[model samples]
Target: MTKPGAVSSAQLSRRSLLRRSALFGGAALLGPAVLSACGDDDAGATAAAASGTKVSTVFSWVKNVEWAGFWVGDDQGYYTDEGIAPDWIGGGPNAPENVQVLEAGKAGIGLASDTLKIIDAAAQGADFVMFAATLQESPVGFAWLDPNIKSIHDLVGKTLGGDSSSPSMIDACFKVNGIANDYNFIQIGADPAPLANGQVDAILCYTTNQVSVLEAQGLTVFSATLTEFGVPLYADALIAKRSFLDANHEAVVRFLRATIKGHEKNIQDPELGARLATEKYGVDLALDYDGQLTENRKQIELWVSDVTRKKGVLWMDKDYIAGPVYEGIRAAGRTELPDVNKLVDLSFLTEAYDGKTTLLSA
Candidate 1:
């Protein structure tokens, strides 16, 4: 019953950035509170800060606060502290992973949502695996508030938003509800203001993101979690090649160490990261990023509810990672399914959180 749609292709050009400093708005609530950990050496325990090892990583997108840890790690010199020099890579439209980059040993790890990338690479003579996931609540659901549209049954003829950014998780949820193909989606940009502004009845959205942004802006959204209604799909995983993991286990562990520190910082001082990210990811976000630091903080906190909050817990679920993922993607008619295991690897996170420090406690 799961069904997905083809994402229209686009180019990967860095767009012109519009800057809005929350501190400029004059509202204390909008301004990011100065946090104590900005440059604090909290990572002394986990990161060895060794030098001479070189690495490369490509980000899925730029300016999304989700990857703030990478920036903070680079800015805070966490990677340097670990003694590894990382050549942070960039991504844009049609990035297509360029598996050869990691395959030919040009890069050490690749970041993706699921093991699909890794699995596909394996199938194609490459190697990869997903480990830790950044976004907890996948946020793959419909964004609508029309009283007449309480459930999927009401979506038969309504105009749903669409775009390559549309999530396959929504398809899984809709299939579980036995409502696939019930409505039509109109493809648009990543920004879902059209749905919020009443341009359409609803928009497929990520709970951890777009809908949350809209709701915080005084717009209420009626949402359905991908797992809540039906299929289970993991989102935004920290992935690396299997061979790479076997070879760079220590470096991978350090990468997770730096990343865990960043996420914990995001959880503890969300405003600081969000504000810095607003200015950091200049082209991606539409709203004032600094103004939305509180929003980002709230969104990230809600992302890791009770279950995933336990110390040393990385939320590793193979069924969630491999199952409905390909089901929905194939159903949605995506060209091919990437290798599930290739898209994921947990050793990094396992080693990262296995330390004496707890992300929840930190």
Candidate 2:
């Protein structure tokens, strides 16, 4: 998922259009490497025929614990074992949207914030299909430094700060608990400073990102995730164009296999993943090592759940896609929900693990 200040979808779409034009114009002058025709599949074939294929993946945000698997996989030569040289693209406020980049053929695979975005993009004829879910549950939640606001029920009469869209999830939670809406929703950015300074009782932010920052600033922050309150939404999924998946089936499988192995390694030893992300992949980001380590551990906890514990990391359970994920989208007022079959393709993940759930032993 994107950090607080990341650009919006509209902004990303415009930037991508410009980038596509520039790339196409440069292709005639620079040759095939600058052309979209040299997609991941062709790259893989070239790798087989020559050295190794280099594939690029556009992440949703800047390098941090959220991308531990990719970093660890690259560091451990997991992608190399698959005959794939990975180009890890860092994203932030200026990076184009993942789906836009994939559709433009700038990147082979991309990570999106949620399936809903992919569904919406597909409706607009993007042809993006999700292959693996990175985080089982979204980390979006309401956080506060006040100890009295322990649960969702306690925020009934308080003022909460967040984007206007955040109310959909909050409303879904209130509906599930049969509680009447009494709290005042104030529109704000993804900053917890207002809550820290007593401007708002709580603020909606990603638990994995902001909670640690709040705690480190000398506040006892308490949080309640949307999933805990009956919104079972998945976050951060790997997606590629349908045409790309159709052409590079084996390449996709190999990529996911290496990726899953990387996640397993992260689960087994989060410190290693943290070190790789901070000291290696994210060296230029000036990330805090201790803060990143804390977030990495929290992210690993989110990656596993009752479903993943048995079905393996990145497992796309049909029941989940059809049930809670669907309901959460509807609750959020998104009506153009794509068909579950069209939205996700789990064949690669299933083949990666041979249809067996694999979990790291504690």
Candidate 3:
């Protein structure tokens, strides 16, 4: 007989949902014919334009919601106003990884999942520097079929899904709640469908994505949250090369500033956001545009609050990062943590909310 706490197959179902946003990046909404932009312009140039120099932004995997804010900025001419003319490129399995591109000078901004990667990158002698965090609450959660599997204790012996990036949070949630880490965790590369297929019991997911996509399929996913249980981590940071920051410091700052406003819009407007997401921004709408858009908007709501605003829109809690984050990652068996200060650059966020940019009403 199955234990009372153990989730049953009946609990997880074909018509279930999971948490939304997580590791997977977004895709562009519309193709070039459907949407158009001034491709080459020195819009983000802070000091001087290098005679028609064009910079490229490598967004992760087509278009996920992580890059929506920047897309909003571009669509609204925010980047043009900032003197930066950027061609936002789609990233995927074939696209260069952020660290590599930044190192090779391929892309200007590097977007990725989890701050843990930040420490690893810096330690590897990678030139990436974290600018701002996209996910305020790390976007880590488990999606099960059964509401009975609400608590961590309920996850025992149940099959979970995710990559190494989120296992710590998953394990932390289980550990803090007194659940065993011995539960089934299938190694899912990037797709959340396996969970929908009922191949695994539940899977780690992001609130702005998998859940929404699954739900859109008329499947009901029971999203289990790590923060609600016990553990927490940072997700989706806006990163850039150290040299890029140094060379185009003002531009980078402006980019961040514009992004905040863009995120603000990204949250407020879903259709326009989704339409723009498809047309300009590269968010993978693959049969789930509304779902993806809905989730992205939800993320904006969960995080973009005054609590995060330190005189402006900043996604960092200083004491928490300096204290909990460091200790937490170390406890997770990471070699070391990145300097909390280095991981967070509040200057741009400060300046934007503090009225630094005179152009876009920042």
RMSD of 2: 9.8
- Sorting all predicted structures by TM-score, with the top scorer first, yields 2, 3, 1
lDDT tens readout by residue for model 1, 183-246: 5666654455566556678776544455554544455556665555554455555665566677
Error of 1 at 224 (Å): 2.2
lDDT of 2 by residue, 198-268 (tens): 77888776777666665555456678777776667777778777888898888888878888888888888
The per-prediction CA RMSD against the true structure, in angstroms, equals 9.5, 9.8, 6.9
Clashes within 3 Å, all models in order: 32, 0, 45
In candidate 3, what are the lDDT values of residues 61-84, reduced to their tens digit?
Answer: 556555667667667766666665
As for lDDT, the candidate ahead, 1 or 3, is 3
Judged by TM-score, which candidate is best? 2
In order of appearance, the predictions have TM-scores of 0.69, 0.78, 0.76
- TM-score for candidate 2, please give it: 0.78
TM-score of 3: 0.76
lDDT score for residue 23 of model 1: 19
TM-score of candidate 1 relative to the true fold? 0.69
